[model samples]
Target: MTFGEKIFKYYQQINVPQDLPTGVEVLYPFDSTEVADLTRSFYMRYFNDKRPRTFLIGINPGRFGGGSTGIPFTDPKILEEKLQIPNTLDKRHELSSRFVYQMIDALGGPEKFYDSFYFTSVCPLGFVRDGKNLNYYDDKALEEALEEYMAGEMRKQLDFGGNEIAFSLGMGKNIKFLKEFNRRHNLFKEIRPLPHPRWIMQYRLKRLDEFIGVYRETLAPFMPDFHK
Candidate 1:
């Protein structure tokens, strides 16, 4: 089966864990017909091949970006402008999504970059508390509650035919958490951590080009004919 088929099936089966902390709410865009359609379009267009792509797993979805557009790391603007997958979601930008698309452009556009790399998240889902975004690790209780579910879902993603090497999108807590998950599950040969796009955009805006170069360099070894 093509990667898209596998991913679409996975999406249809995932459900929000019922035991979330009292204030935490999960984002499930696939419940929306418009988002499901757009997401299916994006996946089928770029990931129709049966090839095994490398995985770049981030912390979790941001309600404004992937949660809204149903595509990991992609915001509405990038959805329509870069991938040309039109959507009715808000046009407000997301910092992580901006840096990601820019890095994708540097790495040779979406078609080529996405052809070789698949983006998802450690949680494969996102949370919000009091109407604001929340990371899975933000609350200790949430972290503990998701321990098993996260591992199982990650195993499912690995079964989607990714290469042995995986990239952890955030350099700090996310990488630390993913390492534990890997140690327990033996998920990948290596989980290389990158400065997350949100961190680069938020704290290191001046080094945008440098971070892009870092991403380009990390991918160079695995990518064929990559630009130096």
Candidate 2:
């Protein structure tokens, strides 16, 4: 099956739990018909032709980012302006998306960058609590509850192959979890950790270019020949 078909099928089969803890609201943007259609269209447009792609995994989506666009790390503004994928979702600018797009531009534009790399999340879906975005690791109970589900989603993506070395988007809890999980399940040959874009944009804003350079340098060796 084509990459688009595989991803669409995976999304279609995702069983988002509605029984998230009392105060937590799980955001399954893929469940919305419009968002789902747009996501599928985006994949069909960019990932239609089969090709090798390294996987870049984040912890989860954010309220104004992937939660709104159904595309990992993509905010509505970037979706429409940079990715050329029009959407009616709230047009909010997410720091992570902005950084990612900047890195993408430095690596080469979206067409070249996305063709060689695929972005997804450890938890596929996102969560919000008390009006703020929440990561799976925010609560031990929640993390435990979603462990199996996260593994299942990751395995689905692994089945597509070409995910030899996965990039862990967060160096803290995200990399910790990924390392342990990979050690147990042998998911990828390597799991390289990188500072999360959100962290860099928020905490290291003064060194934005430096971080982008780190991204470029780290990713250079793994890039496809054309990208080099």
Candidate 3:
């Protein structure tokens, strides 16, 4: 099967129970027919080949980003405009998505960058509490409850056969959790931590280009021909 086919199937198989903990809501964009179709279309268009890709793991989807578009780190505007993947979701721009695409552009554009890497969250699905985004590490009980599910999803992605080096988006809590998880599971050879795009965009906007440069430097070693 093609890479896109595998991803499409993976998303289809994601089944998070509705009766989550008290205040949590699983933001399943795939539930929306428009999002589901758009996701599949995006994958089919850009990920049609079977090239091995490195993994870049984010914490979870944001409401206006992956939660709406069904693509990791992608907001509606980026999906429609930058990716040229038409969608009917609200066209709200997300800071994280903007930084990600900017880094993508710096790394020789989407076609080359995506061809060598896959973007996904540690938890395949996202969660929210009282309309605010929640990370898996936000609640200890919730994290323990979903450990098996999250590990299963990670293993499933590994089955696709990519570079063993995984990039962790958030260097703080998210990477801390991932390190512990990987120690127990041995999921990846290395989990390199990077600043979350949202954090960089929010607090270090003045150093935007510097952050992009950091992304390029860190990712370059993984893709030898990246700058070419």
**Candidate lDDT (C-alpha), each:** 0.89, 0.86, 0.89
Give the TM-score ranking, best first.
Answer: 1, 3, 2
In terms of TM-score, which candidate is stronger, 1 or 2?
1
Off by over 4 Å in 3: 17-19
Local accuracy of candidate 1 as per-residue lDDT tens digits, 1-228:
889888888887886776888989998888888988987898898889898889999989998898888789999988998788878889989999999999988888888898789999999888888999999999999999998899889889888888999999999999999898899889899898999999999999998899999999898677765653
Against the true structure, candidate 1 reaches a TM-score of: 0.97
True-structure RMSD for candidate 3: 1.2
Model 1 clashing residue pairs (backbone): none
**Candidate 2 stretches greater than 4 Å from native:** 226-228
Clashes of each: 0, 0, 0
Per-residue lDDT of model 3, residues 56-113, tens digit only:
9999898999988889999999988998887777899999999999999999888888
Candidate 2 C-alpha lDDT tens digits along 1-228: 887778778787877854456688898777688888888988888788767679999999999888888889889999999988787888889999999999999988877777778899989899999889999999888887887778877888876555688899999999999999888777789999999999999999999999999999988677666444
Shift of residue 23 alpha carbon in model 2, Å: 2.1
TM-scores for all candidates: the values are: 0.97, 0.94, 0.96
